[model samples]
Target: VVKERNLLEIIQKQFNLTDILINRRLKKRDINQCCQRLLDERQHFLNILTKCRLKIDKNYNLAQNGTISIPWDWSFASNETL
Candidate 1:
């Protein structure tokens, strides 16, 4: 009976150790995934900002060269008596 109890105890210890190792691996994997997702989001935001900056620069250049025209509306100023 004593030998049987010792064997059972050793098996239980090994089982507990394996469980802890698995949990540690899973936690590390979760952390890596979270970091990757954050990096992807940051990259996407930077891309959008770059596109907006390019568009604004193009419009600014066109306006500076007198390429864009704005039509004056008489009705807009009709509200105010000249």
Candidate 2:
């Protein structure tokens, strides 16, 4: 699932995820778009977040990034760390 500013084009292309994220594609979104990622290692058991590098704004609370492993749900679930 992509966000407002998702850099999915480069990520999907580099990772060869066209079939996964974009089943069939030609005209792609700009690489500048950024997105957040969630790790569902164990369904309701666990989760983690990782935001696109390009989305790291100056006001972002990066200090809390990876500072703790919180519940993998809701708002915190969207806080990217990868």
Candidate 3:
């Protein structure tokens, strides 16, 4: 009976250890996925900002050459008070 009890105890300990290891691996995987998702979102936002900057630069250059009128350039107002 003593030998049987010892064997059972050893088996139970190994099972507990395996369970713990599996839990740790699952948590690590979840964290990695979350980090990757955040990185993807940040890259998408940066791409949008880059496109906006390029468009603004193009508009500014066109306005400087008088090829297009900027909406904020209100210098052509008459002296009529409203």
Highest lDDT: give the candidate number.
2
Off by over 4 Å in 2: 1-6, 20-82
List TM-score per model, in order: 0.21, 0.20, 0.21
lDDT of 3 by residue, 12-33 (tens): 2432322111113233444344
Clashing pairs in 1: none
Q: Taking the tens digit of each residue's C-alpha lDDT, what string does model 1 give over 1-82?
A: 3543343233324323221111132334443443333234443334322222111111123235333211111122325431
In model 1, the runs with Cα more than 4 Å from the true position are: 1-26, 43-82
| lDDT score, candidate 3 | 0.28
lDDT of 2 by residue, 1-82 (tens): 3542255443433433322232122223221222223222323322222231212222234234332222212243546543
Which stretches in model 3 have alpha-carbon errors above 4 Å? Answer: 1-26, 43-82
Q: Give each model's whole-structure lDDT.
A: 0.28, 0.29, 0.28
C-alpha-based local distance difference test score of model 2 = 0.29
